[model samples]
Target: MPKSPETLLEQEFGLIAELVHAHARARPRHPALIDECSRVDFGELDQRMDRVATSLQRDLVDVGDAIAICAAASVNYGVVFLGALRAGVAVAPLSPSSTAESLATMLADCRAKFLFLDEHVAKTMATVALPSGLQLVRLDHSPGVRSLEAWLAPAGSVPVPVTIEPDAAFNIIYSSGTTGTPKGIVQPHSMRWAHVRRARNFGYDNEAVTLCSTPLYSNTTLVSFFPAIAGGGTVVLMPKFEAGKFLELSQRYRVTHAMLVPVQYQRLMDREDFDRCDLSSYRMKFCTSAPFSAALKADILRRWPGGLIEYYGMTEGGGTCMLLAHQFPDKLHTVGQPVTGHDIRLIDEQGRPVPVGSIGEVVGRSAAMMKGYFNQPDKTAEAEWYDAEGKRFIRTGDVGRFDADGFLTLMDRRKDMIISGGFNIYPSDLEAVLFQHPAVRDGAVVGVPSREWGETPIAFVVLRPGATASADDIKQWTNSRLGKTQRLSAVELTTELPRNSIGKVLKRELRDRYAQASS
Candidate 1:
C-alpha cells in the first residue's frame, strides 16, 4: 500500500514524485490532469512519468542535470515537468515570449542538455545558435522532428529511483522582466513543499478541481499546480486565457480552486456573461503577482462566490502576506498580516528595523526561500540582507508600512519612489487618485528626470471607451486631489500600458518612452 498524502507531506524530506506515484497507486482511475485535447488519469500519468525518467537516464542525463522547456501549457508539459522531478533532474521552464537571443542565453546559463519546445518556439529559435550537442525534442508532433512520444521509453519501463534532498533544485523560474537577461531563481524542493503543505489551508483535497489559466512557465501557475496534484485533485490547464473560454471550462470541470492575477479577474468581472456562468462550485479563488485594487476586491466579494484570498510575496521566497479578503472587507486596502512562521520586518536603508507604523523596505525570511540565483552568486548576494544576528532574509524591494492592526500597506517599489525637492512621492498614492476619475480606465505614474525638481512625476492614462477626456482634463482633475509634492508634471494618453507576462506594469519602459518623446 502506498503512503497516505498526509504521511508523505509530513516527512522531513519528501519528493513530489513520490506523492504523485502514491496517489496513482491508491486511485488509479481518478483524473489527474486535464488539458484541452487530453485527460490523463493518475495511473497513466504515473506510468508516463516513469517512461520519461527512464528515457532521460538512457540518454545519460544523470541526477541533478537540468533540462529546458519552452512551450504553451499542456498535459505533455506537465508530464515532462513531473517526470524530471522523478529522475532527480531540475527543470528550467523558459518563457516563449522571450526573444530568441534570451532563450539561447538562458539555455546556456542552466547548461541544459535537452531543449523541449513546441513549433511556435522552434520557429522563434530558428535563427539563434544553440549550444553544441544539446538535444532538441519537439513537445508537439512535427514531421521530421523528435516528438515527445518518440523520446519516451516503453509504457512498462520503470525508472531507477534516486533520493531527493530537501535542498535540491526543483525548478529554476527565470525572473519576469520586459528587458535584459533575466536572472534564474533557483527554487528548491523544500520551497515547493512549503506551498504544498499550505495548500490544505485553502481547502485542497481529492475532490478539488483547480483551474490554471496562466502560462506554466510562471511561478503563479506552479504554486497552485503542485498542490492540487499532491492532494490528489484534478487540474484543468488552459492553453490560452480568454475570459469566455475560462468561464466555459470552469463550469464544465466544476472547478473549485483557481489562482489568477488581478488583471485576469478584472477581465472576468468585466465580461457580460460572467454572472450567467455556473461558478457556484468554486470554493476558493486566489489572486497575486500585481497590485489588486481595493475596489476590485470589494466587487469580487459582493458578486463572486466562495472565499477570496490575495497573496503578497515574491518568487524568490522571503516573507508572505495573505489577505483573506472575504473575512476582512475593511482591510481591503492592506495586504493582510504575515503568514504563520513567516518573519516579515520593515528595515531602513541602513538595515535597522523601522519603528512601528513607519514605511521602509520589506524583507522576509521563511522556510520556503530560494537557494539563490542560478550561476549568479553576486546577484544573489545583492538580493539578500543579513540581519545583525546573522539571519539572512530576501530583500523584497517594496516599501510598505504595517498598520497598528498588523496589516501591511504597500507604498511602491523602493526604486520607483519619486524624490522631488527632497520630498518622497509614492506613485501608488497618485495612481489611486487617478483611478478615482470616472473617465480613467487605467493609469500608471512614473518618475522622470526633471531640470528643476531633479525628478518629476508623469501620468499615463488609459481612458474609458467612448469617454471624451483630454490629457489636460485628466491631469487637472488628478492634480487637484494630490498633495503639492505628489502632483504630476504632465499627463500622456495611451491605449494601454506595457505589462509583463504576469500583470506588473513595466515602469522602466514607460520612463524610457517619456524620455524618447521629450528628446
Candidate 2:
C-alpha cells in the first residue's frame, strides 16, 4: 500500500530530493520527464541533479541562498530546479515574459548569485538592462555567456548533504503584476509538501502522466508539475502554448492528467480535430489562475473524458476552494467548498464578517498558504486579516458569497468592482451574459471614467469566426438583458482579448488602452 500523506510527511524519506533518489534506485530506466527537445529518465535526472548540487557548493552557494532562472520551459530547467532544491538553495523561476525592468527588479530582489538564462533571454538582456555580478550560464551556447555545460560539476561528483527543515524556504514565486509591481511570495518546503500530498487525492500515482503546457514559472502549472514528480509519474512540458501541438502531445503520450487554465480549454475544445483525438487515458483535469465558466465546464464534461476540477486561489496561498465538477454536477455554477483543513469566509470592507450568503471579499487560511512576501513586512501585513479570536487569514482580493450548502459563487475582484450611481456592479455577471450570445466568442468589461455616473462599464468583445455582428448590435442586445445599474456604456469589437502567460485576461491593459470618458 502507498504511504499516507501524514505518514509521508513525518517520515525521514519525506524530502523531495530523497524521494527522487529512491525513484532513481527503484526505477532507473523509467522516463521521468519528456519535452519536445529531449527526454530524461529517473536515473539520469538524479545524476544531473547531483552534478548541479555539487556545482552550487563549489561556487559557495550555501543553504538559504537563492538561484534565479529565466528561460523558456524545457527539460533543462527541470533539472536545474531539482539540483538547486537538493543543494538546499531556493530556486526563483523568473518569467521570461516579464519586461526587462521587471526582470531586473525580481533578480535583484532575490539576490541570486547564479543565473541560468536561455539564449533568447540572454539576447534580450544584452540590449536591455542586465543584473550585474551574476555568474551567468546560458542554457545554450551564446557569444558572451558561459555555457551551462561548462559550469556543471564532474559527472560522477556528489554533493554534501544538508539538513532541510520542513519550514525551510523553498521558492519565491513573484506575482503576475495584474495591478502593478509584483510582490515575491515566499513558499516554504512544508507548503509545497502539502501540495504534493493533496495531489494524491486527485489520483496521481506511479502510472500517472501529467501534461503541462503553461509556463513553469507560474504557480498554476506547478500545482501539477511537482505532483507528477512526487507521484513518480512522467511529466510532459511544452515550451509554449499551441492548440494543435497540445492535442498531438496529449494523444501521443496518452496523457492521464492535466492542469490548464480555462482559456486553454476553450481553445482545445474549439479545435476541429478535438473529438478525433484519443484522450481516453485522461483521469483528471485541473484548472486555476482564472475564472472557469459553468457553461464551459458542462461542455467539457460532455465531451472530455475525465473528472473536471476547478481551483480558486491566489499564488500567495491564503486559502483555496475546489469545485469538483465531476462529483457535483448540480453545483457547476459554484466554485464548490473548501478542501480538507481549509477555512474560507467572506468579509465586508471594514474586515468584519458579513451575513452568510451575502457577497463580500474572500479570505481564507489553509495548510498550503505561503509564509509571506519576501523582505516586505508591510506588504505582507497588508495582505493579512485577523479575526476576534486572533486567527489569521489572507485576503484573496476577490468578492464572493457562499450558499446554504457551502458552495462559493464568485462575483468579482474587490478592486475590479464598479460602483456607478451608488450601486455595485460585477463585471463577471456581465461577462457571463456576453458569453451567452452565440455571436460572442470572448469578451471583457472594464470600468471607464464617467461624468454622469462616476464609473461605468465599457466592454470589448471578440466575435466568433464568420459571425458578422456589429458592435452596436451586440451592445444593444446585451444591454437589454442587464439590470439598470449593470448595463454596459458601449461595446467595442476586437480580434482577441489580451491575456498574460497564465491565460488570465489583462483587464488593467484593456482599461488603460481604452481610457475614455463614459457617456
Winner by lDDT: 1
**Total backbone collisions for each predicted model:** 0, 0
The C-alpha lDDT values of all candidates are 0.88, 0.83
Tens digits of lDDT, candidate 1, 1-519: 568877887776677899888889888999999998998999999999999999999999988899989999999999999999999999999877666766888888888989899998898778789987789999887555699998999989999988888899999988732234558899999999999998889889989999999889888899999999999999999988888999999999999999987767888898998888889999999988767789989999988899999999988999999999999999999999999999999999898999999999999999999999999899999999998899999998899999999999999776576655434456776787799899999999999876455578999999999999999999999877654456789999999999999999999899999999999
lDDT of 2: 0.83
Residues 1-519 of candidate 2: C-alpha lDDT, one tens digit per residue: 544433454553367776777778778898888888799998999999999999999999999999998887888899999999999999888877555655777888888888899877786566555667778888755668887788999898999999898778789998632113457898888778888888888888878999989888888888889888877889999998888998899889999999887767888888889999898999999987665678889999999998999998877887889999999999999888998899998999999999997999999998777888988899999999998999889998888999999999998776676655323456876787788789999999888766455568989999999999999889888876664457888998999889999999999889877864322
Best by TM-score: 1
Which stretches of model 1 miss by more than 4 angstroms?
176-179, 416-519
- If scored against the real structure, what TM-score would every candidate get? 0.82, 0.80
